[model samples]
Every structure is written in structure tokens, then in C-alpha cells.
Target: MSPVNTSSSLRPSSFLLMGIPGLEATAQHWISIPLCSMYLLALLGNLLLLAVIQSDPSLHEPMYLFLATLAITDLVLSTSTLPQMLAIFWLGPRSISFHSCMAQMFFIHTFSSVESGILVAMALDRYVAICLPLRHSAILKPSTVARMVLLILLRGLVLIPPFALLLWRLPFCGHRVIPHAYCEHMAVVKLACADTTANTMYGLAVALFVVGLDTLCIALSYTMILRAVFGLPSSQERLKALSTCASHCCVILIFYIPGLFSFLTHRFGHNVPHHIHILLATLYLLVPPMLNPIVYGVKTKQIRIRVVRVFCVRVA
Candidate 1:
């Protein structure tokens, strides 16, 4: 229980991050093994996915461009939290400066927002490719996809600062020990001595709005996709169309289900165990990044072949 620095009573100069509730002293070392492994896999998977997509000229389409954006987002999102999480597990509770904490808070939420938007974009890409095949290239041109990715990044950048800013304006007079793995928005805000109604309401609103809108877009896109697939004259055509979407559907489920669960449980699961909540929160970032490339590499033929070619070339 040490402050990184002393400051005015309004806010401490730094906050101590408890690696994980109830496990910090004993089980953390054991926990770090899997955490570190997942982190390394996530890094390797996403980086390799990017390299594969970039090396193959055939993957330079709108769909692959969106996948590349997603790989980058996954890299940023996982990197934002896992390194610090591993450090805390290895080194015990660590003190983070106020600004550093806020910056972490910003990147974590911002890139999460970006990832959500990217998912929606990918869904739309699939929708266009399936439901409007003839116009797909016309609709999702390279320039258009580039602009879409830029806007998605900008949306996250624009929307997520308010979460950190709202917390910043509040006074933190309580103990600055955050009782979780990283500087989660709600976890850090809970230490504020003043009213956090604004933080709570704003955080809830933004989460619901982004998640809701994105979920609706994905659902609608898939609904149309399903209808179009079924309308195909041949059973083989239907299966072929569905096969193309299977990987994306898997990615969406992994990305959103755990994410929404962790988010809601953090806000409303009053009786849930703290360790479970923290683990879910931590994994919500790690699991998808680790799985995304594997899912795509297995499900997409082009990526699989290129991945083999890349490794074969290196081995030779």
C-alpha cells in the first residue's frame, strides 16, 4: 500500500493496481503462466495474420483489408492490458501514475470501441459480398474500405476520451488501490470520493449505444445474408455461401459474448465472485486475439495456403 507520489487530497498522484483479488499473494504466479502464454499466442497469431494478408496480393480485397484492420485492433487491444497484467502478476501489486493509469484506461476502452466498429464493418462486408455479390466490389472499393477503417478508428478516438475525462474530473479521496488486474473504467472510478453518477450513467450509455448499435448492424447483416443464402437455387451454393460466413460468425461470437458478459457482470453482478469477474475481464481481451487468426487460418482457404507458403519459404 504505497502511493507512487503524494499530491493534493483531491486526487492521489498514483494508483496501485491489485493484480487480481484474493490471488495476488499466492496464486498469481500460477496464474501468470497461462496469461503469459495466451498473450504470446495472441501477439504471434495477429502478427502472422497481418503478414500473411500483406504478403499475398489476392488478399488485398475489401474483406481482407477489414481483416487486417481487425488484426491491428486486436494487437493494440491486447497489448494495452496484458503486459501490465503480467507485470503485476509477476512483481506483485504495482503502482501506476495517475496519468499513466488514465492513458491505459483510454487505450483499453478506445481500442475496444474500435474493435467493435471493425466487427460491424466486417459484417457489412460479408453482407455485401453475399446479398449483393455483383455490386460488392463497387460498394467496398479499396478507397472506400480505407475510409471506413479510418472512420471506425476515429469514432473510437472521439467517443472514448469522455470516459477517461469524466473520471479525471472526479476527485479520488479514497484509497487508490484498484482491486482488479488493470485500470478498468468502472474499477478506477469506484475509488472516487465524489458522486460518480455521471461516470456510471455515461459509461453505461456509451457501452449500450456502441454495443447495441453494432450488434443490431451485425444481426441485420447476417439476417440478410441468411435470407440470400437460402434463396440461392442450389444447395451447394447455399452451403458455399454459409461457409464463407462461418469464420466471421465465430469471430463475432467470441468477441461479443464474453465482452458483454464481463461488462454487464462488472456493472450489475452484485453477487458474483470478484475473481471470476476479473478473470472474465482479463480474458475478454486475450481470448479473441488469440483465437481470431486460428479461426481465420483454418476457415479461410486463401489465408491457410499463404500461411503454409510463408512458413515453408522460411524453413527452406
Candidate 2:
């Protein structure tokens, strides 16, 4: 029925995961509706952000360019799964097919990789700006930023596809159902009928190499950036630098801390409540996408101005 990939018979789901009431069904009756509302807001905000960056000549530099690209990636990464996942929360059969599972898993991982790369790039941009203000423009030129993005893209193409394919090659003959909603790597891979030691090892390696490494590097970059900011000649300069980095630091913390905790708790924490687990899973998918535009808008004045300018031009 789907063109995503090779179709197999819908495997009989073994896990109920949720209870008889199917919170997905009763969710509207009790749970907050803002979950879906916020996702839509983020989608719109990111679109406005992209339009702003494209419209404003002032925002053509590497930093905003990367931010715009990050916005697009966030849109795609969240849209890949959230919209359908939301639908399931409101509708019946909150289930995904094998091929659809693979596709979601790939995009989720790919865009996650892209986000980490963009954050590192943003950190580098800040470092250059603070430590070498005189040559910031030359170091972070448009061409260089473009090339960086292109490299991330090429790497994603080369690396992400193989994981998706490898996942497909494994059999899901055991438990047809995944424990969580959607096709998360750890969640779905557990369902595979074939030995999952290889998949689990690959997933763990990727997590450590990609997410772990990114966090460590970003932290280091900020350390240097902070030291440089503190050594600045003027109080005004220090304040400005801190202002610019405040939102980024908050965004980084927001995105990473919960993710690390959730990943760890899910795998190791014992006797976790069903609702809590599901909520963390929901946050993992939703928080970064929703908060990203807000982060950029609040932290970067240029992006805010550009967003207003683009909207005004459209209105005129």
C-alpha cells in the first residue's frame, strides 16, 4: 500500500505497550491538546525563519545560513514522524509498517546528525566571532558555510542509507509490534526476529560517536568562546557575547540533557512508569523541533528582524 519500500505482510503485533483504553484514543479527553498545536506553530515559525533568511541580505552570512538550514532540517525531521504520530494519538491503529518504520528511523537519525553538525558549526562561528572579530567574515564566508553544509549532506547520504538498508535486511518475525510509537531505532530493532546484537551495537556506536562526540565538542568550543568573551576589552562586548550565546546554550542544554537521560533511563532504569516513558519519548521527538525557532528568534536579532521584514513584504 505504501511506496516507501518493499512491503511485507503486516506482522501480528505482540506488544500492547499501552493499556485497553488506548490513551491515544482518550488522549484528547485528558491530555493536553497543545502538543499538536505546538508542532504546527513550530512548522510555521521555521517556514517564516527560512523566508526571512532568504529575504534579508544582512542574514546572508554563514551563521544565519546555517541556522536557516537547521530550520529546514528540523521541519523535515519532525514532520517525518510527528504528524503521523499525532494522527495516531487522535485516531485508531497507531501502527507503522516495516518500510515506513525504516524510513522514519533513517530521517530521525539523519536530521539528528544534521542538527548536531549545525550546532557545532554555530559554535565555531561564535568562536571565530569572539576570538578573531577582525577576520570573522573571512573565516566564516558564505562559500565556506556552503561547503560545510554540503559535506554534512554528502556524509548523511553515504552513512544514513546503509543503516536503513541494514535494518531492512533484518527480520521482524518475532514481535511484530514495536514497544514505542513510530519506528525508533532502539524501539523497533528490539522487534526484529533476527539477532539484533549487530543493530544494537551499531546504534550504540552511532549514538556515542555522533551525539556523544558532538556534545563534547560543542562544550569545548563554548569553553573557549566563553574564555575569549571574558577577556574582551569592554563590558559591552562581554554582555553582547553572553547575550548571543545564552539562547544557544539553553537550546543545546534543552536538546541534549533530556535526550541523554531518556536514552539511558529507557535502557537501564527499572520500573519506569508507562506514562513517564511515553512522555519522555514524546519529548525526544517534539522539544527540539518546537524550541529551535523560538531559540533562534529570541537569541538572534537579525533573524527576528528578517522574519518581520519578510512578513511585511508579503502583506504589502
Candidate 3:
């Protein structure tokens, strides 16, 4: 070996991120145009929502506060990956430092977990408002809302560290190319040369235990809300209560359905085309942030009015 060594393996210090597999260079540029547009819409919409909530004193209730928290989470979630993704697509800086890649993965997953928790909090808020209307204000005061936000933040903070650390410890000696746009937890871990059993199992555990539990709780809350809504004496009252939850239900479906599909396909559908997986992952990341604000703006009458008034004032 000392005389004529031909097979020495060296771990790459950096990773090349393929923004989307099977897309040509020109096609990537075309895709970037739409991707950048979505990023702008997400930022503008979330910021506008925040500004409206802040300026309006009447929206100082728990529901609006939770919405504000959701806006902030969506803002972070989109920002966490879009710029780097755009760089990979628009320019050609496809290389990410190992540590930087790890950081990106951490932020992406942490904010995602936070968003899921915020949705659950919103469900609980709606349940209180509809199921226990008389005690809604007493039960969900500003202090309680603040605590809920803190707990949501803590939930992400606690759950993501171990995942990140596990990935960090794995020795990645193979090709340092990520096949997707962003540094998704599983995507990065799959590049490791070491035994990935722990990483795989822990990731599955987080998805099943954390997100699964959140989904279950949200379902229970909504079921109870439905029962209460049905028990209302007047059909109009039931409709009003159900209307309050419409936007939330839409947001929940948008956030979870694509994500679940992407997760399942990533794990099981080895025969699925590479581009399909990448596209689904991209949609999972981009769609919710871009759509949540629109859903709320169109569904919530007060927000719609405020948005219209703001536009009118600006035009005038």
C-alpha cells in the first residue's frame, strides 16, 4: 500500500446541493423564476399580516395572537431555505459547507416543528372559542397565549437538537452531493457513509411521535369543536362557529397532507422517479407559506377588510 496505494478514500469537506435532480440548467433557471416569486409572496404576505395585527388594537385576542405566531413561523420557515435554494438554482453556488448544511437542516426542521405546534395551538384556541364560548376569554388570556408560544418554541428546541446532533456525528465519506434543493434532515443523513440505523430510526420516531401526536391532538380538538358546533340551537350559530375554523382547517390540510405524502414516498417509493420526489419536496416546502396568508386574508372578514383598507389608503 505504501508503495502503490490506489484506493484511498477521503471525506469531502463540502457538499454539493443539486437543487433539483433531472432538471437541466436552463430548466433550473426557469424554475427559479417561479420559486423566487413564491418566496416574495410569502414574505410580503406574512409581513403584511404581522403589521395589520400589530396596528389593530381589536385583534389583541388569543386567536389573532396565535395567528401572529403562525405568521412569524411561516416567515422563518420560508426564509430558512429559499435564499440558498435560489442561489443553487439561479447562480451556481451549489456547494454548501458541512457545518452550514447542518445549520440549514436544523433551522428547517426546527421551524417546521414550531409551525406544527402553532397549528395545534390554533386548534385549541378554536375549541375554546366554540366549545366553551362563555369561558373563552377567561381560559385563553394574553398570558396563556404567551405561554403557549413559549411552549411551542420549547417543543421545537427540545426535539431538533438530538436529530441535528445525530446527523452531525455521522461520518459522510461518500459522494457529497445532496439530490434535493434544501438540506432536509433525511436527505442529508442518507449521504452518510456510516451506519445510519440510529439516524433513520430517530427521524422516524420524531415524525411518528411528535408530528403524529400533534395530528392526533388536533383531530380530537376539532372533533370536540364539531360536536359543540352541532349542538348550537340555531343553524346560523353553528355556521358561524364552523366558519371561524374554515381557514384553520384549510391551513392544516395544506401543511400536513403534502408533507405526509412526501415523507411516505421518500421512505417507500424507491421506484418513484427522482424528479417526482424533488418536486413533491419543493411543493411541501413552498406551498404552505405562500398560501396560508392568502387563505386567512380571504377567509377572515376582518383581515380582508383591513387588507382592502390598507390598499385603498396606499392608492389614495
**Best by lDDT, which number?**
1
List model 1 lDDT by residue over 89-153, tens digit each: 99999999999998999988899988899999999999999988899999999999999999988
Query: Which candidate ranks first by TM-score, i.e. highest?
Result: 1
Tens digit per residue, CA lDDT, model 2, 1-316: 5523222333432332321124655663344367777788879888878877887787788788988888888888778877766665666445565666767878887887888788888888888887788999888888899999988776666666667666666655556655565566777666666677777777677778878778888889899998988998999989998998888787788778777876776578768765567667767768887898888897788777766776798899
lDDT of 1 at 49: 92
Q: Which ranges in model 2 have alpha carbons more than 4 Å from their true place?
A: 1-22, 28-32, 309-316
Poorest lDDT segment (10 consecutive residues) of candidate 1:
1-10
RMSD of candidate 1 to the true fold?
Answer: 3.2
Sorted by TM-score (best first), the order is 1, 3, 2
The count of backbone overlaps in candidate 3 is 0
Candidate 3 residues 1-316, lDDT tens each? 3311211233466788888888846588998899899999999999999999999998899988999999998888889888888998887648888778878888888888899999999999999988788999999999999998999899888888888777656666566888989888888888877788998888889889778999999999999999989998999998988899999999999999988987888789899898778877887878899999999999999899999999999999
Better of 1 and 3 by TM-score: 1
lDDT of model 1 at residue 143?
96
Q: What is the overall TM-score of model 3 with all chains considered together?
A: 0.94
Error of 2 at 310 (Å): 5.0
